[model samples]
Target: MQGATRTPAYAGRGGSRSIIALAGTLITVFIVNSLIGLFAIQYAGDADVRDQTTLARLSHALDTAREAQVAFKIQVQEWKNVLLRGGDAKDYDRYLASFEEQERRVRDRLEALAAAAGDLGLDAAAMQAALADHATLAARYRDGLALFDRTHPASVAVVDRAVRGIDRPMDEAIDALAEAARARAAAIRADLEAARAERYRTLRTVAIASMLVGIALVGAILVRTSVRRA
Candidate 1:
């Protein structure tokens, strides 16, 4: 009878120890999982912020470039209309000045965009080439205006050709750049989304793994205690 009583007491003490050990293991796993989750959240947030900032800058640059292109085109068309109307010399001079001013402003805007692009690690050689083409067109336009001042009938035709030459190539270059910027923005957005998904996956996996470990520890403790009791 005494032996039976002592056996139960011994078994009870062993069960308590097993339960404590299991609890400690569970606590450790919980802490580890919590840390991992926190880190993942932080990383995801940082990536999202960086991607958003880049997208905003790219969008702004594209908008500015497009606006500058439109303004330049309008000026060219106005000059063409003046020449077609056989306007006076003063009118021609005024139109030429206006065209030059618009051209200069567009160039300045392009330069600003290039500077912003440099910060974004963009390839700016295309932009530079486009700008060079624009300069050539401007020079040709100025020459054509000079011919007009001298009463040359072919001046209008030459100016028209020059404007066409510059406008088409400039438009193409701007379109290409805008498309590239949009593609990059799309890629960044996709990457950010993927990162967020991956973080969630990681957290889910950690939570599941932690739960499994806890259950296993509890089962092991219960089993050991049961064996000791038997």
Candidate 2:
């Protein structure tokens, strides 16, 4: 007698549903982890941008403020030279021209520093006061120079006296501005360091969370596969 052939049963709908659910869970975990990574990257980029901006503003403030101080000193020296060597008309003219050049340089640097401070959302009031003092000093020098021009070789005493009266205050104001700029720069550096540390911490947290999630999802998928096989 011929035996009837039996057909093997198809895989059940329950097994298919289990596979679908596992796939969905894995996809969801991947998406969540990817979002976390992307968010961390974006946050780090934002922090970097902020740090760069702070560094640029601080550099501009400090460097330009110092350069302006040097230029003002040169101006003061030229003022002294005008008093000492202006007996000759040509020497007076040369020294006066040099003084004017230095004045222009100082003004330019001050403007640049003020602009940088403003851009950094800082108060330029202190810098403005220094600029005002500079203007007063320049006016005094101009008056002294004019007096010297009319009474060359004889107005030395008057010019010296005027410069002597103004030099200390003028230097003090410039020094104050530079000191303020230095203080501001130090604060910016601290902020940058803090931001850097924060970014590292955030990245580490995200990495650890992602690793744990990945491990859990993999374990779940392995269990599901084994169950399906069994």
Candidate 3:
């Protein structure tokens, strides 16, 4: 009549409750969604870490296998030295001891490689077979050295001819295992990268969604305040 009609006291409380409700709902949605996004990203990060660990282990195993090959070559070289210079007892004993030591090193490395490969779910059967063949070849070398009568140095030639290329198959097997390991590492790296990218994309999407919702909520609050003032 004289001016605007008076608002009931309960009406102001009701309006306040409405603003509170609206803010609470939007805030809750924003917080809950952000928490979920963080948890999801953490899970993805854990998975990526596990994959990287696997790749590292495989790489170490491959290195162990290669080292085993190098030790085997050294063992073979010692065997050759034993043949050439072993006419003397002292030289023969030293060369034979060196040969035996290198053989032990090779075996140890291969054993480590096998264990690592098996743990990583790789097939080590071919490498194991190669190791067995190496044992046979080593035995022949031992026998050849034993037969070296202080009189017959030419018998080394007979032993050499017999075991000339016995290592070819084992060499091939090691190469195959290395190739397989490389392929697996590549696949793991690719998968890890993809997972990282996906994680980033999901996080970006959540951030964008939250920002938009916040902007809308601010706009709504400003409008409601203006309406209340009016």
Candidate 4:
């Protein structure tokens, strides 16, 4: 009679359950990692958008500040014209009108700068300081203009004195405000960079963990297959 054929033993229910558990764990880990990666990517994109918006606002604020400064200087020129050549009623009226026009432009741009700063979530301290300086300067300018309207020749010394005291200080304050805005922009850029770095770090960690999990699952599968074959 032929010898009875030998048969391999089954891995049994416990082994089957272990393999299922490992497969389930691997799938769950993969899904979780994918979701985490997607979230990180979206967060990074949002951060980039915020950074771009902030930079644009900063540019607008700086431009407004510069334009306001130019308008202020034009107002000073108009004052000089009124004090020097405004003896005639026509010349005096023309210069005064020009001064008023430039003043309005300056005030408008200053307000725009303040709005931009507020939108960017920046402290409006510098802008407020500049505005206060502008107010003080405007008061002095009006005083000089009043003196000139009544007596043009007598207005020369008064206007010159106010220009030295008020105009120069106002210009300096505007310069300071512009510098502060630039500094704030730099800080925002730095913050964005830091956030990006953190995002990358998290992604790296996730990638490493995923790789380790894959290795472990693969090793466990190989061992089980070998035992089954044996």
Q: Flag clash pairs in model 4.
A: none
Indicate the worst ten consecutive residues by lDDT in candidate 4.
Answer: 5-14
Best-to-worst order by TM-score is 2, 3, 4, 1
Error of 2 at 19 (Å): 3.3
Stretches of candidate 1 off by over 4 Å are 1-4, 7-9, 81-98, 116-123, 150-166
User: Which 10-residue window in model 1 sums to the lowest lDDT?
Assistant: 144-153
Across residues 29-148, which tens digit of lDDT does each residue of candidate 3 receive?
A: 678777867887787778778877877887887677778777877887888888888889999889989999989888787678667667766667865776787787778776666666
Task: State the lDDT of candidate 2 residue by residue for 1-230, as single tens digits.
Answer: 36976533444565676678778877887888888888888988887897887788788778888998899899888878878887888987899899899998988888787777776654588667767878887887777666665454567887677667687787777777888788878987887898799779978987888879877877887787687667
**By the TM-score metric, which is better: model 1 or model 3?**
3
Best by lDDT: 2
| lDDT score, candidate 2 | 0.79
| Prediction 4 TM-score vs. true | 0.76
Off by over 4 Å in 4: 9-30, 85-94, 114-126, 149-158, 161-164
**What is the per-residue lDDT of model 1 for residues 103-163, given as tens digits with 9 covering 90 to 100?**
7877886777677767765557866776787787778666665555336666677656645
User: TM-score for model 2?
Assistant: 0.82
Question: What's the TM-score of every candidate structure?
Answer: 0.74, 0.82, 0.80, 0.76
Task: Name the better of 2 and 4 by lDDT.
Answer: 2
RMSD for each of the candidates: 3.8, 3.6, 3.2, 3.6
What residue pairs clash in candidate 2, if any at all? none
